[model samples]
Target: MKTSLIKLTLPLAAAGLLAACAGGPQPPDWQLEAKGSMDRSVAAYMEGNSRVEMAELERARTQLTRSGRADLLATAELLHCATRVASLVVDEPCTGFEKLRPDATEAQRAYADYLQGKVQPQGIPLLPESQRAAAAGNAGALQGIADPLSKLVAAGVMLQTGKASPEVITQAIDTSSAQGWRRPLLAWLGVQLRRAEQGGDTQAADRLRRRIELTQGISAAARPLTPVTKP
Candidate 1:
């Protein structure tokens, strides 16, 4: 009976050891924390809450780094950098983006390209050939991008390259404005307004000026006025 008991215990002990080596059934706490934070950050960004998005992204970065999850860490870093770039925050380099996983999703890859193009429109040759071609006013380029923001960026690229027609860019700007994407809408309007002026299209330029003023007024109205405090 004693020998049989020892034999039964030995296999159970080995199995337990193997399970421990496998890192157990549940994920580490930090990984779960990081994933939750990332989801919230993305949600905040989509809702256009820049302050909340940045804060959540910073939390995700910290949690991912603590978890030693390199893939997630890289993704978080890329998102953080991309947000900063979109907000026109100067001096913040897009670090760890080049180290993104080879199998990164299409959205991730597209965003990286957009950032690179924005940073060095005249010199960076990193954007995909197909996207570059799209920037040259090929409607086909728009087909590959499913994300609205990416499509908008692609259209902006076309405008910057002097390859898109006024009608094409105006359509893009209108779409962004309808979606309440104020930043991109304003930026695209500024670009088209400048183009109209340079071409001596006084009528088109005046229309763009009025649109800019109206958009700015709407934005200002949406913002809460700060209360004055007495010293």
Candidate 2:
């Protein structure tokens, strides 16, 4: 589901490449490079590859900077923040995008608000297609999003709105698991594990615990360790 504000605004891989092949006017070099880098950055972040995520983000920033389009840069930052929100990292104030807010279009501002749980009725039309119905309080609309990441982001928004039902949580977990996005998979599993424990469903809790342990083990082994010293 290429449903983010950036995705709505940008041409994607197959179509853009085909256009180039057909000798049609292609997207500007900076646009293509920025979009690709940003997409990789989001995917790497979802997969818990922080090193690659930051590297690709920097590449995106470089390309966007070359274009001198602050709005586009702001869109990139919002995309990064939105992915974090979807992964349950909900504390972001989107300062990077906020710094460039004056240059952002109405749709960009609406998306920024949407990520922050400030969805307004007037802003609904401006939001990405996959999220519009969800923003309007229809959780079923999430199921309509074919893209896993888009559904997750929409679910995150529903969570903020006090509407993340059990089914939504399950879908989020399934999507994260299917995508091999360990970060969100762990986050959603933790949510389910807590619920299972609270409900005294020992069987479910045990199963979730083992899954969490397996996922964490894989992530820990792939991640580099940093030592800390006490003063």
Quick one: best TM-score, which candidate?
Answer: 2
Candidate 2 local lDDT, 69-108, one digit each (tens): 6766777888788887778777768888899888877887
Model 1, residue 216: distance off in Å is 1.7
For model 1, which pairs clash?
none
Each model's backbone clash number? 0, 1
Q: lDDT by residue for model 1 over 8-38, one digit each (tens)?
A: 1112122221132246766656655655676
Clash tally for model 1: 0
Q: Each model's C-alpha lDDT?
A: 0.52, 0.76
Compare the candidates by lDDT and give the number of the best one.
2
User: Candidate 2: where are CA atoms >4 Å away?
Assistant: 1-24, 224-231
TM-score of each: 0.56, 0.85
